[model samples]
Target: MTSTRLSVIDEIFLRTHRGYGVPIALQGVWRTTGTVSRDELVRIHDRLAVGKLGRRVGKPRIPGARLRWDLSPGSLPLECDTEAVENIVAWADAQADVPLDPQYGPGWRMTAARLAHGGTVVSLVCSHALADARGLIDAAAQSFSGSAVPEPISSPGSDAADALRMILTVLVRSIIATARLWVSARARAELRAFATSDSARTPPHRVRKMRSVVVDIDASQWDSAAEVAGGSANALFVSVVAATMAELGSPAVIVDIPFRTGSGDANSIGMATVNIRGDDSPAVVRAACKAAFAAPVGAPAGYPPEVVQLLPHRLAATLTSTPGRGEVLCSNIGEIPPALSTLGPHRSCGLATRAIHPAAIGPLPCATIRLSTYLSRMDGRYTLSLVSTDDALVESTEELTAAVHRALEKRNLAGTPW
Candidate 1:
């Protein structure tokens, strides 16, 4: 038997869910050429539930112990909208508002709607605490290929015994971490000045909603635009995002790029940071990206993972700082699996993936980072997904879509919005 524990990042996401009631879920939308029947939707949903997304986070038996995964079947049923909608993108965005519980079980949901014109829009929303973007994609690909679900991995010992061992290990690591912090002058200084400004805080009175826009560009045109801009596809993506943020009145742009670390953990992603300007050419952005890739990946927080995991959710939230105003997350999902292009007897014409907060209501928790962009290549086209959380900046979907078009025009590229 093998033991599986929650990673530091996963633990942080869990804290956010329990403390703030925010269901930060990853959503993937697929536009198929033909309508998917209810029976087919159920079939796909059952397959996904048996995959990696089937597990839930099991709380530690005692305080200061680690959290484990409870291998069990999901209970959330497939949600189907009987009403046919013309705008599939809008329908997909509405599905993000559905509640998903990561701790209890069924940390994911699959919804489908038929397009009035002629196709089907299917969306799968998985709790971030359960899986990241890549993990979700992998699970979908495996399910589509009719792969057999692996047997659940069991714990080596009792929960009490595991707790005892974890507590002892954490004690030793915490001592070492405390000693390092005491000796490092920079660490001491940072701790003394660890506080956010009032302006940086998310106002509780601000009524904000998450609005998303999907744009699809021809593969040949995207490639040609990237070549003309003197950068690779990823660099072009970053440039467009930076420009869009700049158009929204950002002074400086700091982009976080998540790279795969090959770890089998649910959220096995290492982040790299790069700084760029709205007017910077794609070549400049490309250079910055190249430099960031070469640099070492840093820890996500100031404190050690062992220490943070030991603290209560309220205290742990303070340790995990929110992204600043001009910060943007540019996740390039790269090429998607061909299996995902076909879902339940229909071929997908376009696909988009993004992270959404289902419980986004009165006071946004991490509202400083107003915009996030995701890129995925499928079916000879590049689908760019944009999620804007700041009502003050984006105001409306049309404004956000217009800004994107303007940014693309500067790069001599054009796209069709969904």
Candidate 2:
């Protein structure tokens, strides 16, 4: 029997959930040309229940021991909406309210609804503690490909013995982490100095309600605009988001880009930051992005994982600082997998992905980040999903949609709002 420990990032998310912060989850929406039969939806849900998305966290018997994953199948069933809906996007947003417990069981939920006009929309919501964008995509692809599901392996030793071994391992690793923590502290000081700049101040006005906008653009046009701007597709995406934030009155935008670290943990992406002005051209932003990506990817800035695991959840939360107002998380999911393009007998016409915070219903204690953008390409269309937590900048979904249009228009690219 083998034991898999939670990664540092995973531990952070888990701690955050247990502390004051709400558990964040990822939502994937796929639009099909026709209705996916109820039976087919059930089959898809069952397959996913047995995949990676199904697992939940298993806490150690003693503190200081790393958390493990309970590889048992998830207990969530296929949720089908009997009535047709006018707006599938709105329905998808509502699905976020559904509860998903990562530590107990059923870390994911799947729902399907038919469009008023035609077609079907199916959504899968997975707790961020269980999987990230890449992990969720892989789970779906594996399920659709008829791949064999691996059975969970039992632990070799007794529970108490396993816990004792893990605690001893943590003790040894904590000593090494202490040395590294000193080095990390110096680096963090430099980061804090940079963050204290006037441009990094929080934006004015605070509102609690979060709004999101989804738009679809022609893939050819998007690619052409990127080429004409002398930048790649990714550069264009960053430029658009930066420009949009700037137009919304953010002086400078600190973009957080997520890259895969080739880890099997729930949150395997390493974060890289790039600061840009609204007036920066796509080419300039491209160069900055390239440099940022080339920089080393490591643990997030905070207390070391070993140190955090030893502390209480509330204490760990107190030590971690809130993100700056100018910060914007930009995730480019790239292309949709072919296996996900077809669900049962229906082919997907569009795909939209975004992260939702179920507990963020009112104003947060601190100023929220300005915006978050998620980009994905499916079929011949590019779906650009935007979420604004700062109500001051984006008062409503209509305002965000208009801002997206203007931003894309500036780049000679146009998209239809979803």
Candidate 3:
């Protein structure tokens, strides 16, 4: 018997056409309290790898044909010091001159980063355009026997938490479905704001420099809001961000909502990244999100082909709006496990995460707001990173944070992802 160099699914990565070259990095914070072992870490890596074990089709930007399905590499080190993590990210602002390899099935690369005191920071940066946010979290949960996996239709909420994970199988299926769905009238409607607006008709001004700042905020704010709004923590955070954009002058925004409904069908708890593009009206965006979560029970359908094929144009239009595009890009990676703190006994638990966008928006890209909550704690960490040549935006992280806080205070909760 010969050892399989790579799984059959892995070989398909080079053939995937959905711009599979995109890189997605998600960091898992595990406390060293119980003696974290390499075996445990590898197990987590393996589970996530298994989640991407399916066949492939056309070729994507990443090189190689035989290894295409997931294009994720096994966990590798981020190659920098604890303090360097911040610097490395800041440097990437001008250009992503950094080297990235997606041959791994999860495109899931790892960095066994060591903190100043002790312990390890396991970071997995995969592609967001390919995988959904929920799927990323599910991969982490499987490593530690987390409760949320997709199971049979035996019980309710099974869609979000059951564990039938034939990852690759569902991935290809979702892609095909999404492509087909996006190729219809719905896709046009979904992108109406971008396509119809005259302000979005022209090309955007060239970008001069791209600067980004990443900070960790407390999730307790989200928890309190979720409690009051009666919605999932993720939904509340997104609503808050949408509301903030509304106040900032852009009354329209597009948010990528991840879907994990396949889990209910005994499929792997993977994510289908969908655009719940809506006007930045706080009330409108909130109502849309709330409805998606409040749906009695049903997985959101994949985007059709029309939607997929026209996404670039839609994206370009959105970016072309106004003297400059919207001032905020908010992403809420809901409750990370408290164990994600990669520090030793001397350090308090902390989780570090980053979100990326395409490079088309000139030297300076989009401004981003990231929020993550923990199930065990009332607080959540909110990081605001803005990409721009604007001096005022670059200088004041506190101002952005304060604005976000106020937006959350007035968010309405009545929307749905569907």
| lDDT to native, each model | 0.76, 0.74, 0.37
User: What TM-score would each prediction reach against the true structure?
Assistant: 0.89, 0.86, 0.49
Clashes of each: 0, 0, 84
Ranked candidates (TM-score, high to low): 1, 2, 3
- The TM-score of predicted model 3 comes to 0.49
Q: Write the per-residue lDDT of candidate 3 for residues 46-118, one digit (tens) a residue.
A: 5555453111122333222111132232443333333423233343332233333344332444444443344
lDDT over C-alpha atoms for residue 76 of model 1: 77
* Candidate with the larger lDDT of 1 and 2: 1
Say which prediction, candidate 2 or candidate 3, comes out ahead on lDDT.
Answer: 2
Model 1 C-alpha lDDT per residue in residues 219-305, reported as the tens digit of each score: 888888999889989999999998888777774677778888766666777677788899988888999989988863443225445
In candidate 2, how many Å is residue 113 off?
0.9
Model 1 worst lDDT run, 10 consecutive residues = 198-207
Q: Which candidate order results from sorting by lDDT in descending order?
A: 1, 2, 3
User: What TM-score should be assigned to candidate 1?
Assistant: 0.89
Best-fitting candidate, scored by lDDT: 1
The list of candidate 1 runs beyond 4 A from truth reads 1-3, 148-151, 156-207, 294-303, 322-326, 360-366
